[model samples]
Target: MNIKLIVLFFSLYCLFFVASILFPIDFNWYNSLHKPSYTPSGKTIGIIWAFLYSFISLSVCIVVSMVESFKKAKWFFILFIINYIFNQLFSFFQFEQKNILLATIDCGFVSVTAILLAITAYKHSKTSFILLIPYSLWSIFATYLNYNIYLLNI
Candidate 1:
């Protein structure tokens, strides 16, 4: 394993995680919202995100390490950037701005971009592609949850 590459990917994930923390979700406001009964508790959400981010970092490291061409590497980074932006924006919209509709849209973007990353990574590293499944599924679930929140709150 390339230690430097692992560090880079993990560092990038940490940056987003820290930024989300800095923005800080307003739990009071979030709790006030009309959430679905299936909505996970705050602690559960945190635990899941922690695991997902760690897996995402590992998957990205594997994909980045396996890319055989500069062009493919560039495309991978581009997709990563888009996914990162959408991931962060979901928190910004949901927690900071308290907009469930925009958050739902952001979550949708995250899900789409996540699957794209998985598909693209499939050509380079099957392990990387398989590793992304959980994140993609969780993103889809989160999108559904967010959409439901939007509907119920509307």
Candidate 2:
């Protein structure tokens, strides 16, 4: 395992924490909205995201570390970067901007990129691919939740 790559990937993922801080969820507004029946509690959502982020970071680290050169890691880098941006933007769209529609759209993008990232990871590192499964599944589930929220509140 590459400790440097692990640290770099994990540190990049840590920015999600910063994004959360910057776009703190407004409980009052969120609570006032009509949420779907299966919407997880905020604490549960937080816990799930924590797990997902760790797995995702580690998965990326594994894939990138296994690659002998940056050229070989280019696809992983592209997919991961796209996924990271969309992942981080969810808080900004849903919490800060308070836009259910935009957030729903963002969730779809996140899910797509996550699946792509996982598929791409499989060729380089099966461990990385397996690690990404939960993230991919969760993103799809989250997309469902977000879409329902949009429908319920619209």
Candidate 3:
């Protein structure tokens, strides 16, 4: 694809994250009460998300640019997008009704998808791989948060 397509793709990626934050959607009803042992404040979350999103955008650019021979690798990007969409849904179910099990499952899927994507990206582009580093680490951290929330709520 062209650079325009790649840029559009990355812009769309950040747009979704922005959409998620703009809404008052919560991830879990239990999350409101259960404090994470290492939960950062809202400000911290914003900063971290901004950084992660930047990394994700660059990695996505590389992925999109490499979409020819790496057609199979495209699944990694697809999964990444799917995870974000599902994550929003997960947050809806979690905050709307406190569905811990379902939310936990969603988190698990997202965590796994991100890790797998990270590996694929690493194998393809060194710059993209480096970009994915923080995202992978954060996914792991989010998994912990999701699991703990489930444990505390259930």
Question: Candidate 1 residues 77-97, lDDT tens each?
Answer: 789789988998887888878
The C-alpha RMSD of each candidate to the native structure, in angstroms, is 1.4, 1.4, 3.4
Candidate 3 global lDDT: 0.71
What order do candidates take by TM-score, descending? 2, 1, 3
Prediction 3 TM-score vs. true: 0.77
User: Model 3 misses residue 44 by how many Å?
Assistant: 1.3
Better of 1 and 3 by lDDT: 1
Where does candidate 2 clash, by residue pair?
none
Whole-model lDDT values for every prediction: 0.86, 0.88, 0.71
Model 3 Cα lDDT, one tens digit per residue, 11-119: 8666757545544555353436676678777678768878887777778777767667546686776777786676566556556656767867877776777777788
Clashes, model 3: 0
Q: Could you tell me the lDDT of residue 43 within candidate 2? A: 95
Off by over 4 Å in 1: none
Ranking by lDDT: 2, 1, 3
* Candidate 1 whole-model C-alpha lDDT, 0 to 1: 0.86
Best by lDDT: 2
lDDT of 1 at 38: 99
